[model samples]
Target: MAYKKEHVKERFRPKPGKLLDQVREVMHYHHYAIRTEKTYIKWILDYIRFNGTRHPREMGKPEIERFLSHLAVNRKLAPSTQNQALHAIIFLYKYVLDMPLNDYIDATRSKKQKRLPRVLSQSEISEFFKHISGTKELMAKLLYGSGLRLMECIRLRVKDVDFENHQIIARDGKGGKDRATVLPKPIREDLRLHLKGVRKLFEQDLAEGRADVYMPHALAKKYSGAGKSWLWQWVFPAKNYSKDPRTKKIRRHHAHETGLQKAVANAAKKAGINKRVGPHVLRHSFATHMLEAGKDIRRVQELLGHADVRTTMIYTNVMITNFETLGSPLDNLDND
Candidate 1:
């Protein structure tokens, strides 16, 4: 029985490599998203560096607690950021190193901040659009018009947009869930014109034998040539080809999110809107305006692809309130 147990442990041990490489191998074996893999690897590296380059196997729960506490107390990271680091370290120890942490990690937890989502007024939305043009304008419109998250908009494929049904399918959205969202009728023609250009790029890539886009999960193997097909092409392809970070194969990816992020920031400054703005602010505006127009909260929740109605309910708190109809108590007292 002792010999059998040792044999089993040897058979399941991780392949020999540097620790980060081993982490990547284990993460890939579990089918983690590339973004998630990158995030986890970064945090794990930070954890190792914080502990004076000590091997993680040498340090355990107390070291983790101190690192997390430092992030909360010294670095002043948000609660979410601290949680991310904790999760990353946990993944490293538990999965890659086969060292599950103890239940109690007494880290100084970061306080969760209760902040409202920033939304743009309908008039402000119009003003913001006036300053943005070209592809960024269309992308911004999708954020407001379709209630898409920034990554969702960036990652859209050619077949995801359904003009006939007047809906956009957000495939593998947040939480790896798929949902359909509205496609504003007003932007249909603009979207079609934009696709005509994307189609040309697709054809060019095909002629050069470089048309493949990244496929999710086992689909690349299941379908074989689907990655090279028109249906899988990015709706918003990058201006130039680049090497895939993981595969090292040169291909055109979807446009970088930073371009739209910078555009939104610059447009907000140019339009003179005071509040901090980003791509997500447009999504918040979409939810708020939808509710303001008497749209059902349930319907808005579906459109936003929120897992819970409570998550959508936060918009109600920030929705426009009519002041004229509900005047102050001083007005009822006949002030003046």
Candidate 2:
């Protein structure tokens, strides 16, 4: 029953023609977000197609520079969009192809836009919420109340909320950071009632043998069966199960972000607010209103998870000018 040594060697050798599969494996190993995995793959495929599908291993810096230039000059992409393409290619070479990029790529950079965020006033905020109801309304409330990004509100897990402390622990927020934020007292009872419904859905999922959600950073392995646990369930679960892109297993996910976006947009339109408003506008309103209410900018920085106070200071530009804070020159003259 002896086996051929060549056949044995063949079994251990890596299979050919699976570069993208290899990239996916590497990304999974690094615990990249599912959305990021999809986005990176898209950019990589676009790069390949733009260059007539030449294998990435055959291309180097000149080709990389040329493609990035095309994105800026030809496609007229934003700087962030071009940078995403660059990062995808860099990841492919560095991690998947085992080749590192040079210190400088020397490509034409894309256009940078420094537009300020759109914000809603307090009355407009009231009007905006009046037009929407149910889960989306709750999501919008949390976005404005907790100073949460749209996706941050979407991805909240059950265990991350602290009802007693009146705070929410936003897990894995933008830039891979986490922060604690205040949960509005007004929404507490509604949120608790909402969770009761969600818990019932979780129980139903368990009874029907479909109660599992995605976990980050190989946590699903270390804490096997934790995915189906009540604490790990999404605070706002999707209405349906879908195939996970990485594992190919059917798992329920957080509510799709687009649905919330559409709901908020329609709600804004129906509310007859003139200015362009979206989920992010609510976040902007949160920061502005907090500052207006005399909350310290540094404290707002921590709650909003801003890396620097400079970033938080953008909200100050939208604050109403308080001339009273600087007594009028006429008043000063009268005093003198």
Worst 10 residues of 2 by lDDT: 1-10
Q: What is the lDDT of candidate 2?
A: 0.87
In model 1, the clashing pairs are: none
Candidate 2 per-residue lDDT, tens place, 38-74, comes to 8999999988888899999898888888999999999
**Per model, how many backbone clashes are there?**
0, 0
Please give the lDDT score at residue 288 for candidate 2: 96
State the TM-score for model 1. 0.93
Compared with the true structure, what per-residue lDDT tens digits does model 1 show for residues 62-123? 88999999999999999889988888887787778888775678899888788899999999
Residue 78, candidate 2: alpha-carbon lDDT? 94
- Which residue pairs come into collision in candidate 2? none
